[model samples]
Target: MRVLEMLLVTSCVLVLMVSLFRNTINRKIGTIAGIACGSLLAAQLLFEGYRWQMIPVYIVAALLVALLLFRRSKITKPLRFMILALSIVLLGVSVALSVLLPVFHLPKPSGGFSVGTETFHFIDADREETFTEQKGDKRELVVQVWYPAAASGRSGEKNTVFPKDRGLFHTYMQAYSGYLGLPAPALDYWKYSRANSSIHTDLHPAINPYPMVLLSHGMGVGRILHTSQAEHLASHGYIVFAIDHTYSTVVTAFPDKRVTGFLTEQSQDRLFEDSRAILHVWNEDITFVVDQLEKLHSGAVASKFKGMLDMDNIGMMGHSFGGAAAFEAVYSNPRIKAGVNMDGTLFITENRDAMKKPFMFMKSEEFTNINEKQAKYRKTPATDAELKELRLTREQFDNILANRELELKLMDRLSQQGQGRTIYIEGTGHYNFTDLQLYSPLIGLTGMTRSINGTRGAEIVNRYLLEFFNQHLRGTESKLLAGPTEDYPEVKYPNSVYQGE
Candidate 1:
């Protein structure tokens, strides 16, 4: 909390204590005030709690004080009635924000992949030219591409950003601290805040172009969240380009030293519209990147990337909102031969019916036979925020079952066009598919939260992804997808072999 907020709360508490025992004012109020102030100071020092974000608690105390002040007013006792009414209203609002904001949280560490990987930092002037606002200016995004490199022990691993940006990130987190059980306004306890940098992967000369896959992230999440999956795929011979959608990511820093943080725009139409725009950006970026690789392969520039790209095969995948974007992009762009959706709420688009490419849907527990408590724990962000429109317990659980049903429907639809498949991971939550889980553990931030063991999950998913892509895109046979083997017990594919009725 801020100084002003603290003072307001302190005064309110003191006034309320005195009013509660008006008959024995002097000693009782003094003791109560002393206790309250001492507790506040102690909590601040011991737990590193924030003073500003506790506004809800403070607001309630303030109301209690105001009620007392009303009773003691010089004009009339009727003023007390008005004051009590106003305080009650204010208290209600405070509780509402506390419940709805999700202002505080301690996320579990999903962990990162231990497999080998390499990084390429590209400063795209053309990309800089593409991001134009209405005022005739362009915004450039610094994209870091992670891929598999030769087996050389000389390269070191990359790290993520920390410490310097923690204050800002913490401030932004105040918007949703309540749901996170975080220290109201201060999150100094989080291990990630001071542990490491976001730079993972080593810098080395490109090896094989490998199969290319593009990745998109959820709303308000960074592209780095997909590191576990990306690094794992790269280790197994797949080049992954994770796009950092601007203004949507919590914090995205470009090569030019410019950083654009989250800018809230809540309109559903506008949100998906932005996703579509980003999809176009991603398409153009991938096209340009492939062209660059082609040039390098042709000996145009003195480049290390030589004979490394296999442009004939490409795939795309995304999580949450990005999942919807991936579907839309595949429908609109023929370049994407395959696509996957990771527990995303389908968005409106005119092209879903026209899509002919192979697709997959991997749902969380919410998209399967799971309870709400368990469903929310999964990585899939619940799309129903409106109470009136909320799905019933049975309905919501059935939605997960429905997700599988939809997968079958889509697959049957895809078979009509020639190819399709689906896989559902049961025990995992939403963040399991992302890098944040791994990063969290490195910083000692996992605490009591549940996240997919990023390292293990990455290897499993990447192995399957590579096998799937190779079989479909490169015509390489893979027995892994033929059936569920006992080797991988964590994976439960109820629909893969049986073909859900």
Candidate 2:
């Protein structure tokens, strides 16, 4: 909970307790308590903002203040007791809600530049929208760009973590809750979230023509989930583009107020089988976005990106299924120099030997070691007694062994394509690759993320991103990627071969 809000809850509890004993307490004590409650309520609203979770508490505080007006009237003891019990329950509920789904902060940017962001709506006429109901519709994309910016803009204002539009933001909140597979009401406090970037801040002339990156979210996820990473890249002198792949996103709110939710027929477990066609569309989306980048400056109204972007030095990256798409971009798109995939398995398994780009996969330990799960069973077969203790049927154990063999075979086929570097973050899970890990501490508790501290995970991820992009995009190089260092012990290159240009 916010500072003023916490204080108000404490004052409300004290006032309610005093009111419950008003017959024994001085009338002046009740008056003072009511005044304090009213004053604190005003301060909370002025500084801390209102929330639906606090509505019950707000009602209780208002009732306490109103009692001061009727101080001469005698109150029944039972009624006072009821008020006390109800107030305590309401306050307790508010505290729990706020703690569970906090208005989280993005870790401060470690680079020299402050971040600035802008959103653009683009439509691809060449490709028809395949997932839509219309007879003929072009694919529409919502792209948000983050760039290095001056310390202050005219308003000196920063952007909200989600959309500023109330209707859209509320819809995003609903979609995010669904994304996490949580109940809709769980993340309602997300409406008050903040980001580290300012909107449309003036860019220094020297910062122009920075290296670029196109960011894609995980399958069925929104682009804002990658905001923290994008901001960090921008601060480090790379212009980053994050796309809300429309129907594929958890939710997308267009400028016309048309809201779209996940329309893709892909699930996490089925992605390897179901995502081939979807991958092509996302690849096209990335290509079309690059094409649109060139056209933005051609219009009569000069785009803010005019001459401020280095289109030739472009890099690509994505999390989960987005990761595979990044590999596709670097492999197929001549304009893309390098890419990284985080914790996503490949959907496009064919013709990948042609992949010679500077690329790597930053995976969670669980995902990285998946092919080796059945290794133990082969080395020292378990006895019937052990199998019974584990409660696995003979066939189930056989199936596990078979699955591991198939995964290993698939990985061997991938290895034939070429050497690929992989960085495994210890005590991490798939969501750790995106800002969703930092949504709340409860995420770690639920095993959505693992034992890694969210902020530490972000720091490690950003440092590598800065290093990789610097070596491939900018003319600089860092030893972090050349070989493993004592620094960032959480990052490992197990079975990894550092690719040199």
Candidate 3:
């Protein structure tokens, strides 16, 4: 909650408490509490902005306070209790609404530099928008770049959360709510949250020619979902470029107010099948974005990045489908010095063996093993009853195991080359890799997330990302990656720890 929001909520509670004993208390004291509650409501509206969740709070509190202040007769004990109970119920609903869609801050970057970001709309005439049949429709993309910025520098700001004009936010989030199985208004308060980023600030002189990382989102997920990780990377002295893969995200809103909804949809089988080419278009998108980044640094284009990007030492990372695509990028692009894949299935099978570079595959514990929780704690295989609850038939279970084995086989082979490693985070789910985990406190109650707190999950993921990139790109090393340690008990190395070592 914002400063004034907290005070207003506290004041409302105080008023209810005092009103419960209104008859017993001195009239002066009761009146003062009522006035304070009303005053705080005005103050919250005047200072901090109001959200829809607070409406019930505002109305109920206002009416109760008005009754206390203006109504002359208070002889009926039963009537007083009814009003108080109704007010309490309304306030409780408000509290639950607030918790379900609480405005939250990104985990503060654990680095010296501040972060700044800028968005660009680019069209590649060389590649047509394949999702469309139009003859001249080119590949359009929205790229947001986050970089280390000087605190003193002047920069324009764009809020990803809670912008004053929210038409774009509504359109974007409404498209996503369907996938989340939530009502359209469930995520309405999300607009009230904001990213901890400024726009297009001068690069921090401390890290000139900062190593760059290209970030990619999962299939049907927007780049906005990865803002937390991207911001953290930028703060720690790296340039992070995240792309909203056109036609792949839930929605993409351009500065021109033209919006495009997700256009690409295919079966999982097509993703792994070579004939389908689910990754082919995405592979080109990654390569093309890098081409544009090169142009920015070429001096031909007027850009602050002209001499401030270490384009030669680039890296790529992604979540889910994006992670799979990162493999293709690093495997195909020699300029990408390192890569990380967070909980993404391998979509590029052909190039798995031929490539060798610094890479890390960050997996969630459940993705690593379905019955890991029971197996680790109780030393038993998942029972048939557990399988029923998991909704997995024995055949499906076997197939999944087979797939996981193949994945681990590749991970182990890759870990043998360069500075590659694979580790899974315990008590985390797939969305834990993205900012979606931080959306609500009740997120864990759903199957999408597990036991890990969203903030703590973000911290752990960022810590490893910084460590991995610092060692591979910046010539630094941390013992945290020199096999697992007590420092992060949640991080578990599968099979042999640090196979490359």
Scored by CA lDDT, what does every candidate get?
Answer: 0.53, 0.79, 0.79
Say what the RMSD of model 1 is. Answer: 12.5
| Top-TM-score structure, candidate number | 3
TM-score of each: 0.57, 0.83, 0.89
TM-score of 3: 0.89
| Tens digits of lDDT, candidate 3, 1-501 | 667766777777777677665665567876887788888888888776678888878987788678667767654678768877887788788878877768887777878888888888989989888888889999999998998887785765755543346787778668878888788787776766778888667767754588999999998878988998999989888999999889888888777989888778674333245312767888899999999999888886687788788987898999998998898889888888889999988744544765768889898977656434423423445569977996777665545445545665677777777556889999899889989888886877777778898888988999999998988888897788888888789999887422221
lDDT of 1 by residue, 1-501 (tens): 334344544555455445443443454455566455545544543554443335555555644533433334342445545654555566455545433332222232222323333334444554453443545344444444555543455444434322235655454455324324555444433322221212343323444456677788887776755755665565555667777666667766654445666663544324445555655665565555455556655777544445665666778788887787677667766667887777665544343545767776666544454433333434454445632365335455444445534544554565456555556664556655554444343222333213455455555565666677667677788787766777766655544322332
Model 1 scores a TM of 0.57
lDDT of 2 by residue, 45-111 (tens): 8787777777777888898899864667777888778877887888888888777767788888988
lDDT of 1 at 180: 42
Question: What ranges in model 1 sit over 4 Å off?
Answer: 1-134, 151-208, 264-266, 269-302, 348-356, 369-412, 415-418, 439-459, 489-501
Q: What's the CA RMSD for each of the models? A: 12.5, 5.1, 4.1
Question: Clashing pairs in model 2?
Answer: none
